[model samples]
Target: MAGDGVRGQETAVLAGGPADGMRITVADRPAVLQVTRPCVVEVPFGDVRVDGLYVYRRDLRVDEEPLRYGFDPASP
Candidate 1:
């Protein structure tokens, strides 16, 4: 699959390395898709198809505001 960025924020990570087995299987009889990873199974909404799959990881962090009112009065 071509490496494309979705929502201009998350990028798709093509299936490779040890995580290649990760896949989503759709059952035509029930109209559902199942995401499988090793020993875990997750059923997500929408039509289950290989063409709609894009995988990526996201990391978020929070930092303190320098102008906040808190202070350590006793510190030398």
Candidate 2:
């Protein structure tokens, strides 16, 4: 659900879990990340496909054009 006329924007690519491959619209890419959010999205996993909240956190690596996020299962 990308919007039009987004200023100084870059793609924040969500990795793993339900939001996998999901792109988030955000403000301009900064040299260092300041603002961030936790993944409260729930998804079905395992053989039972029971819905579980799979939190997401930023990957520790060099920042690229599109910011990448990985699953943070420990987050509550």
Candidate 3:
């Protein structure tokens, strides 16, 4: 079980298999996704269903440098 301020509350349970790779059910939904590769699963806010699943492959490339973040002493 996990709680997120932006996502409200969510309970993720591994329906079967090991922790390394398995199907996870989010919010007790019927749709279960097998996490075999690197990807990002997006679900609608305050909803149990998965809105989208984006898979990251090796073919993808990053041509531009990512933005850097610096620590701010003023921020608590």
Candidate 4:
């Protein structure tokens, strides 16, 4: 499971939006997040929790390269 994807409490990069390229702490393994009430994740900047839409795009073993949220505007 070392290179299968991002594990819990790991830093992942934001795919888009204002948080794009920003790093955040992943609270859940497999990165399962609700798009409806979207979970608040802790960003590296002052550990502030940002509220936004996060969709699971893929899994990566590399740090700061994995996408925590794709934030597709077309999605409902």
Q: Candidate 2 versus the native: TM-score?
A: 0.49
Q: Which 10-residue window of candidate 1 scores lowest in summed lDDT?
A: 62-71
lDDT of 3 by residue, 1-76 (tens): 3554233223333322223223222332223233343334564556344422322111113222221122222322
Candidate 4 pairs with clashing backbones: none
Q: Of 1 and 2, which scores higher on TM-score?
A: 2
Task: Show the colliding residue pairs in model 2.
Answer: none
Clashing pairs in 1: none
Looking at model 2, residue 73 earns an lDDT score of 54
Model 4 segments more than 4 A misplaced? 1-7, 30-67
Instruction: Tell how far residue 69 is off in model 1, in angstroms.
Output: 45
> Mind giving the per-residue lDDT tens digits that candidate 2 earns over 1-76?
2585445766777777667788876575433322234444466445444244556676648376577777565665
Error of 2 at 20 (Å): 0.7
lDDT by residue (1-76, candidate 1, tens digit) is: 2464222222222134233434332121121122234432276547553332323221122122111111122322
Best-to-worst order by lDDT is 2, 4, 3, 1
Pitting candidate 1 against candidate 4, the one with the higher TM-score is 4
Q: How do the predictions measure up, each by TM-score?
A: 0.14, 0.49, 0.21, 0.38
In Å, residue 50's CA in model 2 sits off its true spot by 15
